[model samples]
Target: MSDLEATKTRYEVLGPLLDERLLRLWAAREARAIGSGGAYQVAAATGMSLKAIQTGLGELDLLEALPDGLPLTPVPGRRSNGQRSQPRVRLPGGGRKWTEDKDPTILPALELLLADEVAGDPMGRQRWVRSSLRHLSERLAAQGHSASPTTVSRLLKGLGFSQKSNKRKLGAVGRCPERDAQFLYIAAQRQTFTAAGLPIVSVDTKKKELIGNFRNGGRSWCRSAPEVDEHDFPSKAVCQAVPFGVYDVTKNAGFVVVGTSYNTPQFAVSAIARWWQAEGRDAYPGADRLLILADGGGGNGSRAGAWKVNLQERLCNRHRLTVTVCHYPPGCSKWNPVEHRLFSQISKNWEGQPLRSLDLMLGYIRGTTTRTGLRVSAELDDATYPKGQKVTRDDLGKVSFKPHADCPIRNYTISPQIADQQA
Candidate 1:
């Protein structure tokens, strides 16, 4: 083959395997191996700039002058000893300098813009920019700082800033002063009950779902997308599915009762009672005490007198077990284990799938499992529970309730009442 063709063929074989430095050196070596005007020929064949080839030739000349047996500049390819040479891709401080270094005021301008509408802890080292990168870029440009959105992103990252969505962390309006104290008390109760090997359950009624062909919030793999109703009208629904979950903290198990009836205190207590009969008793054999973690609002809410009365009748007296109830602070229901562990998994499993029937909803709950060996069981309760059922003072007084010294409203115990127990 001709010299140019030979050079082109060699480069095609080895160019992809070499970095910038190695490519330049290889091109220079090939040019030198050829006679005069070899640089022009190599350049035409390999498409390398003449300056790079000349730089490589200069490096070769320097290498020739150096003494033998001294450590040489590392080469890119494998050595005679079968170990690969570790070489610098470029010398230190090589390549284009960063945008911040080029324009010192760019960082300050970015920070000023971030501070204008910053969210999150002001004192935190890691903060996020509220403005989009494009908007920030435009703002910086208007202020005489020439920066692209990509460059602005890099600079923001260097300054411990990132793009983040709004986190649902802040509490609802009128933050309760006793919120922190209630959390601490709940932690203590968990520790005490866990140490004694008693069953501790986190209970909550999940958001009621309309039973029928409805649009679920997530995507799933299917041959064709399932058609659902355009509008989620209650009148269009066949029924509503209210899933009351009891999550066993120690066992990492879940018991969900799907009720078609109203989510009243009676239904909530009956769900717990069902869990105790189906799984709790068998799991914690001979245990006489139970701990329940619930939210401050709902059918099993701390302030629901009927909730306490039902626990006294169904769980405490009927089962002969002492039930200690702890309610999470207002607007803190997400911290409840049932919400994340059991309910979240069930939501994920059934996402994009229409709950066309009560059976389908129960099936999704029953099939839900987690990587942490979580097992779930679900049952359907077609029984009717009318809402707004009030507990009289006489009935509430008969609960044999004992409020704890700390956060009595959120923490209390209901012991089994004797046959002749006084109000």
Candidate 2:
């Protein structure tokens, strides 16, 4: 066939089978088959550049004349034929190397730049910095490295850096020296209560929800996303739902009392009392004591005198059971089992679903359950609870309780004040 006809034949036969690399090799093979000046004809037929055809021809020549008849060892991933089996989109170890790799001092310079923003003890293992990637990139550039914010981000990830939100896990600004000791003590107390077949519950107020068509913070599958009011103004709300949860630690059951009123000590105690009447009494029959694990702050806070007084008057007096209260160290409410085990599930259940009415909020809470056999029951406490109700010195004196030897402020027991028995 003529050189033009040979090139046309090669294109028709190999066009579908060959990629860029193979096509170049095939064109070189066709050029040789058609004899002299055939490279020009193949290039015209295949639309391959003349330089590519010449390079392929050179590779074929080199392969044909191997040194001392050494066995042809083709590239590991390439086909058996001398032709390269893959396109050269990228060469080996090609493209731009990471800026940190190119400049060894970039990461070290970044650390030095973030030294002032590092939180916690400098010598401590856990260190955190609060700086934006753009700021970091600028700082890197100032230190004589060419890095954009994107490059800085990639380098930071390689150096085990990540964007982290502020965790409330940091101990109080003025942290107690006995913080860890208190945690250990609380754990031991819980173990003791569990062993004795006594009832133990973690108590905490889930973030209050505004009852109205407001934007909740998650997604639900529907035909279309629900439209909510643009503004989340409290004035536009019908009422706020204050959920005080009592999570029975052993039973994996939850009792959430949705109060339309303030989250006072009275309301906190009321929720526990309601749990006892509804579920706790049956769950722990003949139990002499009740253990409450709570945060160090809030309505039932360790420092709240009214919290103690109300516990004395409401829970202890009503049930006639010795109530042992253990408050987690300041800024450690996240560790409370109620927060993860119960409240989280409830929040997830109602997420993205607007609470247009108090009843809807209560219904959502009650319907919350988990595959791990978590059963939650919710009640609406419409009774108004007065806030800032102070407990008098006389009332405080009437309360009977003993502080634990370890961490007195965090661990305490409030007993039913039996006037006749005490007398």
Candidate 3:
């Protein structure tokens, strides 16, 4: 057979069950299969991890060829079975013909960047990363490879090798008692048949505001002339709208409090009270308890001083209902509904519009709309938001909590609609 025919024969052996991901991997180091060793070596040579290599091997539909059990070849020269042992398939690194050519410029520049020595100074490091593409381009040309630096930056980015560290962290592995308990609680709730019974509410405070007239995001008409700033004038810190936003899973509707100070127990309880009175009470009529999914940070945080006990007291005092709050792990705040459902739309609606005045800001917020048929209409309550509102020991001690304390935190219900599953 000709060289081209031999190459075709090699790929034909790769099973049909092999998906695109595995096919691409095998195609990378494909060669004549007659004496080719399988995917493990190919993966190593190509710099893929062992797990990836194993997945590629798993796609092979070699059922017709592979025996049910392997026969031991007792001696070096011979097989115990009547049929001869399968030939040791020696694979070559040069696989299929070029389906697509990689951007020649980017690869070489990336190589140069990875191989280069870092300067000790921070400024020098930043400058080098920005300018490396230009230098690498020249090197590539000298080495008979054509590429631009922009192409290199794009390639590195695709590889997830950022100039700065990606701050996201993975959840803990193995025995994490607290996390395991949270998972069990959520699982138990899901087993409930009633929609209102298993309430899952996502709660969070929106991004903090810079208490002054600052450049807001979204597009606006570009300034005809640049306005001069007076450095001599005292800069004012803008008071933040510490909005406590919540989303009910069953209703698919959200409620929020545009408070200036929400770090205290009173303010936090007030937001929940507003929510229970306005949203949860009418919708889930029989529900007596509320389940809140809040972020680990901000005023609604689980770590915040006396937050849970204080909230429980408040719930008992006002609504005669029990309240339980769940916190999403750190850096997982993006999963909160308020960020996507409420704040994202608000940002989009007010894009490029300067939050020049409180009325304008309030108008922008109240006017936010979504194609999903949800419109966020907000109110600007111009009331004094006192800071450092206390939730003292005496305050909590004065109120009574339900069930006298022997309940499993997970098995406990916040809403009144919680019915026995067997019922």
Candidate 4:
């Protein structure tokens, strides 16, 4: 074969396996082997232009001089007047320039505009001025700096500022000293349960969704977007869906029981009971102890009297199982595994789709899956759970429970009092 034909053969063998840089280097090396002005010959054989072959040869020469690990581009002598070192795809400094960089005084002007300096007030009224981006842009223009609202927004972000909405995360009682301690104790309890082959579950009630043709919070890919009611009035809603989720920490499984009525303690315990009867009992046969992780407020709150009483009556007494409860600190419900693992998946499953009927909602929950083998089962609880069902102190005394020494109010275990069951 001719030298050109030999070069073609080498390319055909190594082309698929080699990256762009390696391929270029290989081509240049092959050209060097064929003697002086061999770049023209290699280009003719490979269908690469003579200019590209010459560039490749230049790259090879640079590689010999360059340190082993330095990247091919950004060579010392190759750069010219802010242009890229090499003649390739991307230009040097090719991204959108910061507005603040374009006009240095724009940031300081914005800070002045936002600053609250009342002429006479000692405290200066308020430090934050919530003005529109367009208004700010106009003010900047008046100060001899030309900028659009979009550019102003970009400048603001560069200066560590952003458009923020009201956050309701701060509850009635702010951060507690016992928060970290409770979390650590809960973690320890979970580890103990998991090691002992006992069930550990995170339980929480998902936000109540308005039933019927109401506008959901997200969008889905469809030929055409589904039409929904413009205004979401409670009168127009068919009913509200209260989804109580139970997430199994060990197995990565979820169970959601939807209720049509009030989300009372009775309803919460009932959901747990349903999950135990349907899935838990079969999964862990003869398992006597159940560990529950819950939020500090709402239907299943640590302070809720009805929640414990219902647990005693519906779960402990009826099922003959010891129920250990751990309540997450106030305003920390978002950390609950059920909130993220179960409810988040459910929301994503039925995004932009109207939950017109109970069956549709249940189907969405059941179909929810994750890459980490999350299996979910959902059921509708049509039972009438009456609100305002009070659990007196006398009723609480009847249930036998031992508070953990670490955090008494937050961690406790209610053992079944049945003599035969304990035996």
TM-score: which candidate is best?
Answer: 1
lDDT of 4 by residue, 1-423 (tens): 999899888788887887655667778888899988798888888887776667678878887888878776554324668775553444556656766777777778886665321011111111122467888888888999889999877776664466555557444577879977787687788778988999988898998988888887778899999898889898898888899999998889999999999999999999999999999999999899999999888899898889988898889988988999999888667667787667777887888898887888889989999887999999998888888987778888887778889888988988777765333
lDDT tens digits by residue: candidate 3, 25-122: 46443422323544444444444455654543443434224677875232221253865444232255434332114443546455544432221121
lDDT of 2: 0.81
- What RMSD, rounded to one decimal, does every model reach? 14.3, 14.8, 18.4, 18.4
| Model 2 per-residue lDDT at 164 | 62
- Candidate 2's residue-wise lDDT over 35-62, tens digit each? 8888987888778799989978876776
Order candidates by TM-score, high to low: 1, 4, 2, 3
In model 1, residue pairs whose N, Cα or C atoms come closer than 3 Å (at least 3 residues apart or on different chains), thus clashing, are none
- Go through the candidates in order and give each one's C-alpha lDDT: 0.85, 0.81, 0.52, 0.80
Per-residue error for 134 in candidate 2, Å, reads 34
Candidate 4 has an lDDT of 0.80
Model 3: C-alpha RMSD to truth?
A: 18.4
In model 4, which range of ten residues has the least summed lDDT? 117-126
Candidate 2, superposed: residue stretches over 4 Å from native: 1-172, 419-423
